[model samples]
Target: MGRLQRLSSNACQRLARRAAPQPIIRRRVTYQVAGRDFLVISGYEPDGQRIFYLKKLVRPSLQAGFEFVYPANRRERYDRDVEAISRSLSLVDP
Candidate 1:
C-alpha cells in the first residue's frame, strides 16, 4: 500500500486497540506543514486528557512523527507549543 493508505490503516488499528479499554473520542485530521502533508490522530479521554499522534511520510522509505499527551482542559496552553513542534518537522537526508 501507499504511504497515506498505510498510515491511515495503522492509525485505525491503533484506534481499535485504544478503544478496547474504553470508547475514545477521536478525530483524524490532516495538516500541511513545511510543504508536506501530515496525518494526525487526536484522541480524547473522558477524564479530560488527550493524545496526539502525528505522522508523515518523509520519503518513500521513511516516516517522521511526534506525539503529545496533555490535559484537554489546558489545551489553550498547549496549542502553541504543539503548532510550533508540528511546524518544525522537516525532511532531512539520511
Candidate 2:
C-alpha cells in the first residue's frame, strides 16, 4: 500500500479535530497522534517512487516547529514506513 492504513474510528475523529491544512513546504500536515502533535510529509520522484518523512512536533504550537527538512539521503525511509505499517497492522511482510 502506498499510504498508511486507514485509521480507526476514534483515531479518525481525533485527527479530524486536529488536522490543519497549511501551504506545501517543509511541513505538509499537522495532526495529533496519541494526543501529541506530528508533522508528516511525503514526496514522489519522477521515477514513481514514494517516501514519507515523520517527525514529532512538540511545543506551545508556535514556539517550535520543524525547520526546513526533506527525505533523508538514505533510500530506506520508504522501506521503514512500509514495514512498520505491515508489522503494526499484522499484515504479511512486504
Candidate 3:
C-alpha cells in the first residue's frame, strides 16, 4: 500500500509527529524505464471508495494527480497499461 507523499518537509515532520488517528489508505506501484522512476498510486477511503491517482517522476517532481478508478482485481494489468501510456507521453507545442 502507498503512503501519502509529504507535501513539504514540515508536513512530513508533522505527519511523523502523529496528530491524526484516522486510517489513511493507498496503493502504489512503481516502474522504471530508461533512467527515471515513475509512481502509480491510488488513494481510497476506509470503505473502499477511490479518491485519486498520482503519477510522478520521482526525481524531477513532475506529477499529475486526479481521480480515477479501476477494478481492484485488474489493477496490475492497468498499471502496466498506465506505464505504457506514460512512457509515450511528450510535451508538445501548439
Candidates in order have lDDT scores of: 0.65, 0.44, 0.53
Clashing pairs for predicted structure model 3, backbone only: none
Predicted candidate 3 versus true structure: per-residue lDDT over 13-42, tens digit per residue: 788779667575545433223335555555
Better TM-score candidate (1, 3): 1
| Model 1 alpha-carbon miss at residue 55, Å | 3.4
**lDDT: which is higher, 1 or 3?**
1
Clashing pairs in model 2, backbone N/Cα/C closer than 3 A:
none
Order of candidates by lDDT, top first?
A: 1, 3, 2
* Candidate 1 vs candidate 2, TM-score winner: 1
In terms of TM-score, the best-performing candidate is 1
For model 2, the stretches where C-alpha displacement exceeds 4 angstroms are 1-36, 61-78, 81-94
